[model samples]
Target: MMKLASLGLFVFDASTFPFSDLNRRRDWRYGAAPRIGDRDATQYLGPGDELVTLTGALVPEAGARYGSIKTLATMADQGEAYPFVDGSGVVWGSFIILSMDERRRALLVDGTPRMIDFTVELRRVA
Candidate 1:
């Protein structure tokens, strides 16, 4: 319903929807990658910064949703890692753009990154 472009650093939100039907097997999140414990906590995202699973939206003051968000599994990364890092040395997880119609400006949620055996292409832009 919405067209989404990478905000360079995975800065996504409800307003950020893909232009195409992102309902594919690959587009869903399989799991997260293993992270190092020594990494600085300041560099990682806080629970508030990331979307959380909520039951209902009673408090209108906060951006709480009235639905439950499912937790994704954390699969392993056996191959080369993505070039981007969240300042924690832990690589940013990858998601396959199912039916990603680059020319038509449409993208679908394909399969998990590990299932398809591909890497998420994250880059830094100035």
Candidate 2:
């Protein structure tokens, strides 16, 4: 929903709507061995990892929101990380941009991006 830029200089509001395929996957690592005549034995390791991925697009709100998404997409392309906060003010931690896609018809006649469809894979970094 919103992100605080570094140094608190400004905030980039990238509000997205019609969020699709939003999900979270949590996993753990373990060691398992099969027994000869029985089932199997498992050993617990430790905490594994978590990641959240989703596909969504920016609505045609106004200029500033659209402009900020362009900036974020550029930063995402360079493997930059940012705190992805939702409209509920929940901080999703540092997330690296895995992928971004834009529809060709999303651009306005003035050359500004009106709507952007993107799919991003966000890994949670403690």
Candidate 3:
């Protein structure tokens, strides 16, 4: 099996939790100064913010555990940054979990979800 990516100890792979889509956003900071007779002078401050969003689905029949979401929540509660690295060994940076949203679908008689779709949002801290 091929590894997709990893955030700390949580690995994204075919057997575990595989992400269907990955989105990244990078922003730059700028400052504007008022001018007497011309347009405001804009100065590039530096980098503003960086964010990453991972969306995937978890299927119990496919070996994905629902507790994995809880694990991520625990990591978020710790308020610590984790290194985001791809399968090719590219280190994105240290990031903190900003939010996680999940939707349960195809419920069973016991009220357990047959599939859980989730989105994880992360912010670069380092």
The C-alpha RMSD of each candidate to the native structure, in angstroms, is 17.6, 4.6, 1.1
> Tens-digit lDDT track for model 3 on 60-121?
78877788888899999999999999989899999999999999999999989999999999
- Per-candidate TM equals 0.16, 0.61, 0.94
Residue 59 CA displacement from its true place in model 2, Å: 2.9
Which should have the higher TM-score, number 1 or number 2? 2
Model 2 per-residue lDDT tens digits across residues 1-126: 444222112243444234446677878889899999997899999757777666666666643344545665667667656676654666666667665555534667887766666665666665
TM-score for predicted model 1 compared with the true structure: 0.16
**Among all candidates shown, the one with the greatest lDDT:** 3
Ranking by lDDT: 3, 2, 1
Clashes of each: 16, 0, 0
- The positional error of residue 38 in candidate 3, measured at the CA in angstroms, is 2.2
lDDT of 3: 0.92
TM-score of 2: 0.61
RMSD of 1: 17.6
